[model samples]
Target: MNKSSLKVVAIGGGTGLSTMLRGIKKYTSDITAIVTVSDNGGGSGILREEMNMVPPGDIRNCLVALANTEPIMKQLLQYRFKEGTLKGQNFGNLFLAALADLSGNFEKAVQVTSNVLAITGKVLPVTLENVQLYATFEDDTCVEGETQIVDYSKAHHKMITNIRLEPRNPKPAEAVIEAIEEAEMILLGPGSLYTSIVPNLLIDEVAQAIRTSRAQKIYIANMMSQPGETTGFTVENHIEELEKYIGVGTIDTVIVNNENIPEEYLKKYMEDGAHMLSFDAQHPIWKLIKRIEAPLVRINHEKEYIRHNQEKLAEYIFDDF
Candidate 1:
């Protein structure tokens, strides 16, 4: 299919989803990102508590990613205040918050922001209901908030056993379901396994839509294991954990990074309690899904961080899948 005709739906939140969108938008304008709204941390959590609205942080990131506006406009939205009452708050979050108030709905605010940004594609919240993420540790202790879940896991060294939305079964957004139905390709992850990716699956109809969609379902595996979440998780481990919620065989393809990082950078990540995801040839998940392994990694010299090369990632998806 041609780029303009391909309807692609990407699911997940945070930098990973936005990062992927930057590349995907280069190939197709018919993109829809279904972002998780379960965040309860930082400026987002504060805004949610005070404004009684869904967190806008992730939505803001997605907006900037697909934006075709000037660099100044992008910088303006992303600029965070250094001091004052707005300290630690991002301009984009405030912009979204203001729009939510003016529009009388958070989702509408998102739509308005999308128009203002001149983004290439649409961004849809997974659910409209105000929901929080919760998790139960392997030891059976429960954590109430997304930020707390990460902190507790890291501090206690307990792996998460179960995760779910607080409101249980929030009605999935109509736009989200419709987007999935019309999509030619559906992508998941390259984000936090618990906080970013799985939370979307926890939504009843969202997961159901994915399962029933005729689109080719692809999952971009994280390059590095998250310290507090997937400490020692491998590519297969990530898929297996996801399958627990979405069911086996729902995902048709797995794209993983087989590139090696320099020892210096690897040491830095290891010292921070993270590691490269191991690629196992005999993983049981292989029976259920196709694996596409490649040297998809790109290290940022300035920040000393590693992420999937956006152009390469987009090209691979367009050419191979």
Candidate 2:
């Protein structure tokens, strides 16, 4: 098989998907990012609440990641407005919002924007509907909205039973389904387990399509658990929950961090109530899966530790696929 002809579909939201997309673009131009749209926080939340539109932050990030424009254009799009009423504003978000208004469809807006920017690969939303994410804790308590669920679950220290999308039975975008069918490999997350990966799975058709697809499915585990959402989560626990929600044996491989954390950074993370995820090699769950070590994990200038080197990580995934 010609490696360059490989078709890949990456699913998730936030910086994780963007980072993965950046790396994957190096190997194949035939890539599609099926992003989550359930975000209800920060700039995205404000826009979704006010305009009754799907959150644009994740979409914006994916766009910038896959953009094939000059370096200056990439930098410009990522620039945030830091003054006046626009403080903390993302320029790309505003551009996407305008495109949505002009095209009369969010998906179309993304396509037009990508065409204009000459993005490297396609970026798609799992669903175009304005959907909210809700969580039901193991204690039988329910919290609505992604941001609220994050806050309330943390404050109360509860186990999340499951997460669901609002508006009930949303139809996954046709483009997303098509992408799944065409993909040579499908990747699920290095993002928020609940808010990102699960939101995409909550859409029944999307989940079913993923379960049935012929593509090699890989789960890239998050390096660290999110505070309220996945606290104390082990690598096995993450995969187990995903299997429970989607389907058993849906994932063919698991990529995990093998790099050790520095004591200084580990101490700071401990202070912040977070810790690096552990991969116990002898664990029963580990026995049943294919594990790959990602050894270049480090803190970037952003002050947060990311999974590993992007291009090198992509090389690992590509080799497996």
Candidate 3:
């Protein structure tokens, strides 16, 4: 397929989806990001409570990632207030909130903001309904809200047994379904397994559409395990959990980082109960899915974190897969 003609649909939330977009946009403008709207923390939670709208933080990040606007404009949107009543709130989230109010809909607001930023691709929320993410721990205790669940899991050392939306079986946005149907490739993950990725699949129609779509489904494995989310998770473990929600054989390919991270950075991450996810060639799941291992890792010395090398990752997808 011609690189420019490839229609890619990425699903997930937080920095992972956005980071992937920054690279993918260089090859094709036909991109659609289906973001998770179940965030209930920080600036997003505050905006959701006050404005009675879907969380815009993830949407804002995706827009900025795919944006072709000037550097100053991008910085302006990402700027966060350090003091006053708006302290810790991002300007982009506020901009989306204001646009939602002006347009009388959150999706329309995203479209308007995308146009304003001259974003290469579109970003759509998985569902339009105001939904709450709930998790049931292994201890039989149930928690409401994304932030609370993570905090409880970390503090109590309990694994999440099940996760679902409050208004269960939410109907996905029509645009999200359309995008999945038309996509030539569908990518998931490199984000929080439960909160950022699984929540989107919990939407019945969205999962159904994904399962039935003709696109090549790919799951980008996380470089490092999340503290409370995927602690001690292996590459196959991640795939198993994903299939438990989306159904068996739903994923066609799995991308994992083979490059080793330095001991110093690994030590820092280990202190926080995180570890690099290892890939086992003999894992049974390999029989059902294709594994693409490469040097997809990049370490940020200043921030002291590990992430996928965007350009290398995009190139791998375009040229290899």
What TM-score, computed on C-alpha atoms, does each candidate reach? Answer: 0.97, 0.95, 0.98
lDDT of 1 by residue, 182-300 (tens): 99899998899999999999988888889989999999999998886788788888988888777788899988888899998999998878889997888776877888888888888
Candidate 1, overall lDDT? 0.89
Going through the candidates in the order shown, the clash numbers are 0, 0, 0
lDDT at 71, model 3:
97
Q: After aligning candidate 3 to the native by TM-score, how far in Å is the CA of 175 from where it should be?
A: 0.9
Question: Which residue pairs clash within candidate 1?
Answer: none
RMSD in angstroms between candidate 3 and the native structure over all alpha carbons = 1.0
> Candidate 2 clashing pairs?
none
Best by TM-score: 3
> Which candidate has the highest lDDT of all?
3
Error of 1 at 184 (Å): 0.9
lDDT of 2 at 16: 89
